[model samples]
Target: MSQTNPMPNSNETPTPMAMMQMISSRWVSQPLYVAAELGMNEAFMGKLVDLEMPVIAGGRERTETEYRPLLGAAGFELTNIVPTQTPLSVIESVPV
Candidate 1:
């Protein structure tokens, strides 16, 4: 008779919430990747490079929403239901 190694197993399953988090992480990563590819972070950083404001956010003017889809492709999103020339505080990265 040959000796066999004994293995221990336990019942541990993934919860629905855990699975959801995993799925969401993948979805958000795509957007982040696109944002990085489009140089979104560099663009934003350039604007703030020289500004005299508590917080630097500029050059957000006259952007055509027509290219929003392109931005989506690059994992970037800028949405504002209100019609104003104001720029919202947004950075290029994974959206929360």
Candidate 2:
């Protein structure tokens, strides 16, 4: 009897780093979207805070100041981080 399926054409195996990059890329995307939606990218400019802000309006209690730095670093490995000692910010928000 003959097998209906044969081995894959490529004799080479994918690199561990490459596979990790692919998986990490997909996982990181959601945080970027959330950060953009939350406007953490703008944090570098001024005192922007919603220390009591929810992930969404009428949603769970969340702090943008705390989470923003974390999200940015997690997904992109940010070159800089705002001072952790700075209290929650409340600068005039530019409408998003």
Question: Best candidate, lDDT-wise?
Answer: 1
Q: For candidate 2, write residues 29-95 as lDDT tens digits.
A: 3322212234445565232345333432233333556555544443433333333334432222211
The lDDT values for all models are 0.39, 0.37
Q: Candidate 1 lDDT, tens digit per residue, 16-79? A: 4443344345532343321122334756755654452432223223344543654455444545
TM-score of each candidate structure, all chains considered together: 0.20, 0.20
**Most accurate candidate by TM-score:** 1
Whole-structure CA lDDT of model 2: 0.37
Error of 2 at 84 (Å): 28
Residue clash pairs of candidate 1: 34-74
RMSD of 2: 15.6
